[model samples]
Target: MPVRFVIGREKPGQVSEVAQLISQTLEQERRQRELLEQHYAQYDADDDETGEYATDEEDEDMGPVLPGGDMAIEVFDLPENDDMFSPSDVDTSKLAHKFKELQIKHAVTEAEIQKLKTKLQAAENEKVRWELEKTQLQQNIEENKERMMKLESYWIEAQTLCHTVNEHLKETQSQYQALEKKYNKAKKLIKDFQQKELDFIKRQEAERKKIEDLEKAHLAEVQGLQARIRDLEAEVFRLMKQNGSQVNNNNNIFERQTSFGEVSRGDPVENLDTKQVSCLDGLSQDFNEAVPETERLDSKALKTRAQLSVKNKRQRPSRTRLYDSISSTDGEDSLERKGSLEKEFKQGQEAERERSY
Candidate 1:
């Protein structure tokens, strides 16, 4: 009845029990039919001898027979007997109906057994498919676990590298700050040294200008002293000429005074005559020598003065050459200007001498 039943063992057990029970019922019915056939043959023989047969209404009038009565018939329920029944005693129609029923029931039981076998095969196939699906799911779970382990290791390595890079960047920033401070200090020192050097050069230039001014003042004073000396020499020449004319007038007066004098009485006339002759000779000698000596002295003094003047003019060129050498050390422009001034003064003196001539 239930599909859960084992087909191989349970089907055979049920078919065997049903087949045994049907065989036992058919054997019992066969024995009872044989006994009834024997009794009917005996009654028919007796009735033929008496010239009479029993009718159906007469058998109905004799009713209510007991189990052990003399006229009891064993048709529906009879004891087991080994004797065979006549074919006439068996109801052929009823036997045929029961045999057909047994054949139909056997066909139905065989069809039900075939259906159970097909269902059991299908259930076994479904169990095999479920086992394969379980193995595939377990394999997938193992692969996922391996991948997760690899990802965790990579994340740890990346974190360590990031920490090291941050340390290096901090060191570089500190080095850059120190270098910037030193560069600023060196630049400031260079600027201060340049300022001090410029100030020293300016002071030297101012001192040089003062020395040039002092040299110019000393040259002016020397030129003024030379002009004064020339004026004094001209005055000395004029006084010498006036003294020579006064000496000539004094000689004439002295000769007139000597002519008007008288002789004394106690003296001899010959002595007087000798004295006058000697006096006239001495007076004549003084008049002749004094005038010429004065003239010669005046000419000699003028010649000596002219010679000294010429010598001083010649020496001035040598003095100017020495000044030129000294002035060259100071500057070339100052030396050139001094040379031009000396040339102008010499030209002016030459023009004054030509006007006097």
Candidate 2:
């Protein structure tokens, strides 16, 4: 029979060496046994196969018949039986002991082979497990690399976004700074304008006050002049009344004489005409009045004309009423402008803060 065995590549070198030695020794022993059997068969085939028999006998001779002379002669032949040439008991016993020893050695060798086979199988199983574990580790490594790459990409993107946000913030800061500069300039201009406006208002107020004072002085002067004219007019009126009464008395006397005694009519008429002409000329020269030809024009018209001249000198409105409204309106407008400016300033401050952020 052929000998077959299995071994694992992962098996230890020492074990394989030991098993190889055992297998070589067993094969050599088997070859020796086969050679021995072939030699015995050839010897058996070469032996003679005669089926003849042989008997053993003894012979006596007559030579010993003389005196003590009768001597015995004996002849013996070997037996040719198969039982006589068979192996003895000692040889059979020795062969049986050797066969038992070979059987025990074969049993020990079989046990070693079985142990080696079991060890080899265990080693194969371990190798397969190691290979599987290695494959799993490799796959894990690939997955980890992919994850690391993804994390790196995410980090890069975040950095880029941060950079963009920083740039935007810088731009906003620049814009806010520019706007703040404009606001400051505007504020300065507004302050200057407000100062100018205040100065203008103050100057206008002073001018208005001066105008009012001048108007008051003029009115006072006009009133004083009016009082003096009234006094002069009264004096002139008293003189005119006195002169008229005297003229009337003279006429009455003359008229009584004409009634008592009739004198020459032409001479009295000429004297009366001369006296009337002199009285009219004296009245006109003293009073500075024009003589009215008609009696219908002689009432209060002449006196009213002198009084109207004084009153008409003050033709404009009173200073207080006119200037008070203007001053009040100016004050209100200035207050409103100040409020609007303050509001704009506050808005500018808030915008500056927002830009700073």
Candidate 3:
């Protein structure tokens, strides 16, 4: 018998659906083999039995025999196939060719399934690599956050340090300005002090020269007075010699002449008493009287001159003391140097006078 069947075919790309379809095809083939075996057993049963295939018009040679009359020529149709016996036998070579084509399609399907399995494994590996990358990126982000926080703290500390440094600089600048003012003031004071010292030195020099001149004049006056005193002494000595000779030669001469009345006022013997005449007049009589009056006057004048010379000598020591005080170079302050030179001069004069007396 010839049969026609309708089965849904699966697409090659869907590996699971293709596998399911192949399994269903194999089940259908097994059921077909069972059906064919049953049909063959039925064809070999006893010819005497008229089973469910018996019919009133069945041919004695092709179907079953019937009791005698001339057999009618009849044509019957199978309900499913009218040409089931038309070829009378099946060809084995054509069936084998169809089976070979089915095997080639199944082999191709198996190869396509294997290629898809390989593609799936590759895709899984790519997914794993992407996940690893994501984890590493997250770790890097955390590290960056920590670094940013530390940098902010350092920046704050640096700002505080900068502020302190700026304040210190301001304080230092003010101190420097104050120091500059003090230095300028000191410099001006030094200039004024130096000017005063120079003026003092000049005045001292002038005063010293004046004192020296005065001393020179005083020495000249003393020498002149000494020479006058020497001349007066010689005149007094000559007067004494003349009077001595006259007194010795004129012993009896006073009896002829008046004793005191004949004497002139210029003659020193005129005012003499008799006691004064007898006092061993070895020097000239004029000298004895002349010395009393003239020597007294000259002695008074000499004493006054000597006092003046002593005073001048006292001033000389003071001037020399002032020189000592001026030339001092100890590191004492300017105020010490400012002591009155005149005061020191006076002190020195007093000390010198004490020593001279």
lDDT of 3 by residue, 1-357 (tens): 654333456467765433554566566556654664575466446322532232324433533322342222211111475453344342333334335536644554455445434533454465566568778888888888888898889889889999999999999999999999999999999999999989978866675565556544544544454454455456655654564455444444543445557756665643444323343344334444543332221233334435645755744435633432342222122224223432453464345334322
- The most accurate candidate by lDDT is 2
What is candidate 1's lDDT per residue for 274-341, written digit by digit as tens?
A: 54445445543543343222111113323433454474574443464366345434434433544564
The alpha-carbon lDDT assigned to residue 49 of candidate 3 equals 55
For each candidate, the alpha-carbon lDDT, in order, equals: 0.48, 0.55, 0.50
Predictions: Cα RMSD each = 32.5, 33.8, 26.9
User: After aligning candidate 2 to the native by TM-score, how far in Å is the CA of 40 from where it should be?
Assistant: 55
Compute the lDDT for candidate 1.
0.48
Instruction: Candidate 1: list runs displaced more than 4 Å.
Output: 1-95, 154-357
Q: Candidate 2 vs. truth: CA RMSD?
A: 33.8
Candidate 2 yields a Cα-based lDDT of 0.55
List of clashing residue pairs for candidate 2: 59-73, 64-69, 64-70, 64-71, 65-69, 65-70, 66-69
How many backbone clashes does every candidate have?
Answer: 1, 7, 1
Q: Lowest-scoring 10 consecutive residues by lDDT in candidate 1?
A: 290-299
Rank by lDDT, descending?
2, 3, 1
